[model samples]
Target: MLGDMILRAFRLTVRVSAVVQSSCQCPALHSCRALHSSPVLWAGHNKWSKVKDIKIPKDAARARMIAKYTMMIRIAVREGGANPEFNVALAQLLEQCRNKNLPKATIEGAIKGAKSKQGAQYLYEASGPGGCMLLIEVLTDNNTRSHQEIKRIMVKHGGALCEGARRNFDRKGVVAASRDGISSEKALELAIEAGAEDVQETEDEEEKPILQFICDITSMKAVRSALESLGVHTLSAGLEFVSHTPSLLNHAQLETASTLLEALNDCPDVVRVWDNIHAQNSQGN
Candidate 1:
């Protein structure tokens, strides 16, 4: 779909290029000497603007995706090392990057940068709208600076730094698998057979269904292996601070909570922000 969209944009650009060239060949355009006036470059004044408008959103969305993937890859590299051949987490992440059509050059660049430096990891606990408890993860050389920036962003979004947020979360192993054609009953059965402590169903950024097989932090690789042997393609295997106490959010509260999350994630030093927010109408909230 992205390729087709780019092809369409290319065709439009080619058509516009011819129009621009024809204008450049005009005798009047060449003879014009007005200091305040410029020759018209295209058939429509908004043609270029329209092209930019068409391209910018796609590029921005793609950029956000790459940034997110880059962060994940960096964390994988930091935890497991840069060699995918020996790093199971990194290997799975690389496969996911390919599946999502991420550029090979971008992947390589991220891996290279990931090996350059290391930072102390920290977690910021906060409470947001709708009683949402947040665990904001940070990786930084300067803890004071990162803390100030995160606190500012949180406060700006009507949230504040808080204590006991970590108490609501438990670090556990998570193995994500595609939920295509997989029923709830089937997911439960898979979890049971794979020795997962629990299973949580969720959707990815693409709105595709996924099942997170949760287990002890040390059992991530084993559970992922079991899932794969059982014919379930694993998307990622990692440890996460899974929230145990969920906060139910109404429509307005949900909107505010989401905005707060976006703000938190935008901080460069912030790695991941886990929350215990569930919509009031869904997830038995």
Candidate 2:
């Protein structure tokens, strides 16, 4: 159903706008001052947007792997047990690492490092225009480095660190799982039975159906355990800020917003970036 619809939609769009323009017009950059100052541009089709969109999924998957490894180390230490034989979340995260083809050496290093780590860490926070809350997750040994990097990026993109950005997002346990063989009806049923407060279909264009579940932080372990018991494979199970309502961005602003998201996400300290940005756009503060 989706593939046919996508093909039809693509056909309609391609038919309407067929004019191909090069990103760089001037062939001689040395003569043109504007061209000389500006970044290099590739000639021909404006298919970079499509390519960028495709790249996002791959980037997200890589970022998730990094976060997963970081989390595994933290979990191992917090549990006061380096062995996954006892700690379940650590065990689960390790399983995820294996599935992603992450190196066993990386996994072992995380476990070992966590055992030697000590003390509490700084948690950075930020909010975009219109209260689009962002939680900057980091595990760096240097707080200053993480802060400076995130602060620079956020300010550059019309966003700033908030005094209490954490308050904007409900302190709930958020989990993402793919629909392997289970039907949507059955998944929702299992989720609710497992104490999920709400389930939302994620905005993903992939083979598997993505579902987001919300639950109180305290009940998170139980919820995960319940779902796992039912044999439902969860892609990711972690905490997140669930938006009450997404802030809609205008078509003009959306381009910049996406760019900002990309820049912010590229930073190593930035583990997760959440926005309330919705589909509707209204002007003013």
Candidate 3:
């Protein structure tokens, strides 16, 4: 009986040792197997995951941009007229819509809706970071709801609503044209003849030069027509609120302001956001 008992004790010790050894070796074994096996597949999956993360936001942004442009087109038609040729704003907006690759059917529907006066236009003003002024344009069927939603978004982003914010900015008609086919001198001459108040040339994201013509709101149609008659095709032409007193923001302040503007713009009813922050590049109309 004593010999059997000692044998049983030895077996128990051996079993415990085996368990400890397995516990220690399991992690290393898994690591080795993972290293020797299909790391390429894992890497490919990780890469695809990263691409998906990047693309989903971009696709959503594109969709939002399309929707905003559609709303702008509709508003333009409603305020001016449905006929693009007769309504300069609508004509310019349609050009921009085409440039953005908005669907033809969607554009037509917006025009029809606008002709029926289906929505109300709104302008919201706010004070942003770095003492910048913000002008948010919105169009919706419900003014009260849009106003509340916009105010909420602004306040959430450390901004507050302001009244009569247009007093801080100058309303002007802006026309953006590419410098692809014409010389700067010729573009300037045409713009001046068209009653443009200012002519500035700047490069786009592609480093291609773009010529911008600023004119009185009353002269937008004339300026556009004159440029077109001279064989100068404009990229965009619309009304803009030019800051009377532009504010310069430091890097940190600029970042904060940009974030606030983006948040405001993401609101579905927001058509365009105008700010007083000085920027090297001008936004599309």
Q: Total clashing residue pairs per candidate?
A: 0, 3, 0
What's model 2's lDDT at 203? 43
What does candidate 2's lDDT look like per residue over 1-285, in tens digits? Answer: 999999999998886565322224444544575675445454323357666778777777666657646754675557657767876567767766765667787777778777576434456677775446666666666777778888889899888887877665676686767656566787679878989998776643233467777888788777877887877667666656776756666665666677777787677655456766654535542
| Candidate 2, residue 75: lDDT | 53
Name the best candidate (by lDDT). Answer: 1
Q: Model 1 over residues 1-285: C-alpha lDDT tens digits?
A: 999999999999999999789878885655564432444544365677876897786677567768878877888888889999999778878987886789999999889898786666787899999778999988787999998999899888889999999999998988889887899999999999999989999976555788999999887888889999999988877678898899988888889888988777667787778999978876555
Stretches of candidate 3 off by over 4 Å are 1-40, 115-117, 179-195, 199-211, 221-233, 279-285
Model 3 C-alpha lDDT per residue in residues 1-285, reported as the tens digit of each score: 999999999999999999789968789877776787788779899998987998777788778878887898888887788998899789888888787678999889888877676688888888877677888999988889999998887777777898766778999998888787777788778877878987777653234688888899888878988888877878888888877787776677778887888787788888998877875333311
- In candidate 3, position 216 carries an lDDT of 91
Candidate 1 vs 3: which has more lDDT: 1
TM of each candidate vs. truth: 0.71, 0.62, 0.71
Cα error, candidate 2, residue 123 (Å): 1.7
Residue 145 of model 3 has an lDDT of 91
